[model samples]
Target: MLYGNRSTMSALSRMTEGNRLAQCFLFYGDKGLGKKTLAKWFAQRLLCSGTGEKPCGVCKNCRTVQKNVHPDVIWVPHSGKLQGFSVETVRDICSQAIVAPNSGDKKLYIFADCDRMDTRAQNILLKIIEEPPAFTYFIFTAGSRQTLLPTVISRLVPFAVSACTEDETLTALRELGWPDADAQEAVAAFHGNIGCCISFLEDDNVKLLVSLTKEVVRCIIDKREYDLLKVFFSVSNDRNSALWLLHDLEMVFRDAVTFRLGQDIPSISCDPVGAGMLAGKLSTAKGQYFHKCIGKAHDAIAANVNLQLVMSALCAELMSGK
Candidate 1:
């Protein structure tokens, strides 16, 4: 069950019910928007053996597809290199696609992260995509259509997957047995990206990162520059975790900014007293500056800049403003 993209889902359902579903569909949107999930659901619906609403999940075909055991359903292999999806892999899948379905009336081919496929590979796939066999259906997922070739984009039906609403996200978290407070915090942390929120909930490191983020903010407000240095140093070795910490800080400061504006926004930090104190310490201008610094740090990390240097520079900037 996808939370958002009701329009996309409804359109797909109508296509399925009307027997007019496109042979190739391009599911493009921001990452973590559940495009792949929707593609899988659509695949199951197309291959379903039951007479009920599309994919009757209990049906043998639906069950096999759900478990990734359906012989007629094929996934294009990723090359596991920087370019991803080699020309050879694309050509091979294109050739295999010509074969008839072994199980169901239709054959489904799924291409995940198609945006990462090399231009050469995409070009190689262009002919097959444009004129796939009658029994074959293609589904491709990408962060955006701009990453694909114009020719490739023109040949497929586009399905835009949108972000989930805060309410929809909260409902999903609650249904997963998360307490109200925890679910609220998760929503704030991930901004209603259900996939990200679920990942955050499942990771114990996220809890520690949230606590560390709150403490770092308190240190900055209290002008404890030395303590802030120590805290930043503790996570310097792990760039990935450092990146997550930066994200957590950004969320906290964002909430503080919203709080200062007198908006009753949900906050990632559970400690209202701490958040209020931080909000009082930083005016809108300073909050905005801090946010800018966090964004720069993010770019620096992505550029492979020294983690310790970046963290030290960020801490210094936060303290200097005090």
Candidate 2:
């Protein structure tokens, strides 16, 4: 059961109830936004056999789907160093789509994290996606709809998933048996990103990133160029960690810009005091310039640029202030 984004859930229910659900569906959102979970729930609703609710959870079909043992439901996982599906994998899925359903009335293929899918792979899926068989359905979850090509986007129904309110997130975490202090700490660090909040509590890597993000923000605020570079160097070998750190730092810069404008913004900054200090130290233009540099660094990282070099250059860019 999802706690937030009732609008998207309602839209899914309407599509299912109205018998207007499209052959291809896209659920797009940032990491930890539960696109894949929503995809699973939608799958349950579509394949449920019980008499009451669409996904009468007690039914054998619903139970099998919940346990991921449903014969007619296929979960496509990524398979590469970059965690992307290859052209061959896409072709295999296309071939499998022509087969008859194994058990249920419909055959559903779910592709999670479609953001990492290469364009060639997406092209391979075009034919099946545009005109799938009567008994076939395709579902994809991505960090952003822009990750897919326009042709692919044109053939699919897209749903944008969003995080819950902070209050709601806090409540949900507590209901998960987290203590009040733990819940409040997670909420402060990650706001409504329930997955990330859970990660923050359980994953030491996440805790390190949070600390590093705060450290990076403080270094920027104090104009400590070398220290900034040094902090980034610690996580230089881990690409995902680097990206996560950059995103959190970007959030801090965003809050700083918001603070400069005298606007009250709900911030997910790990270092709110540093954000306020940055708001005083840098002009809006300068703040924005750093923010854009972060974007450049993000792209560089995504393109597989040398992480240490990228960090060094980003440190220089942030300190240059021109």
Candidate 3:
């Protein structure tokens, strides 16, 4: 069940209503915003045999897409430590693009996590994406557009997927059989990010990283560079964990900027108190610099820079401001 982003869904539905949809679409947003979920629903909307309110959930096409078994709806396979599509994989997709769909209406290619798709694979795909075959569609989901090459992005229609409200998240969890209290706790931990909420509940690694993130934020606020470095070194082994850590740390920094601006908005930070401390001490210029450092750290991880080295360099970069 889709949680939120009703506005995004409505806009997409309207596009299909006009039959003016693009051949390629990119759903980009922060992780756990359900970009892939929205992408699948969009596929159902295109393929649904129902009368109105596409993806009529009960339709034959909708069920098949839900099951990922629809002949015309191909979920592209990805592999590698970063879970990227390889050059060979993109080549195979290029070959498959020439074939007609089994259903004769539309053939959809779903690339769920395109955040790590290397430039080589993207370059290999540029020509086909530029001039896709009739009835062939490509949909990509990524954490951000910065991950994709500019040429590839120019050809794909971009849509930003947003997280639902905390209330909506609670409703989604309750529907999934979680008790009200547990649902509330999950919502508190991750706000409207149901995916991360579920992870916080089920994954020890996520729990550890979330806690470590709070500590890292506190260290940053207090200008404890040694403690910050220790925290990074402690979680240096796992690339995904480091990325998650960076994301959370970045959110806290974002929260600090907002706090400094006197904006009391919904926060994405793990440690709001520590974020407040940062707001009090750091100037706006310093805050933007902090954000830049975090972004560079994210870029390094995506570029497959060595995990320990990335962490070490990030520690140095972030503390350099102090």
lDDT of all predictions? 0.81, 0.86, 0.86
Model 2, residue 282: C-alpha shift (Å)? 1.7
**Pairs of residues clashing in candidate 2:** none
Report clash pairs, candidate 3.
Answer: none
Candidate 2 achieves a global lDDT of 0.86
Off by over 4 Å in 1: 17-21, 81-83, 209-322
Residues 48-98 of candidate 3: C-alpha lDDT, one tens digit per residue: 998976789998999999999999999898888778998998999999998
Cα displacement (Å) at residue 100, model 3: 1.0
Order of all candidates by lDDT, from best down to worst? Answer: 2, 3, 1
Which prediction has the highest TM-score against the true structure? Answer: 2
Name the runs in model 3 displaced over 4 angstroms: 18-20, 320-322
lDDT per residue as tens, model 1, 1-322:
6677878887887776655557889998855678888888888888899887777899999898888888988877776534368877888889989999998788999998786677888899889888888888899998788878999999999988877888999998898899999888777767667876777788988777777887898898889999999889988998778877887677677777888999976654434556678789888989888988987896588457899999999999998873
| TM-score winner, 1 or 2 | 2
Q: lDDT at 17 for candidate 1? A: 62
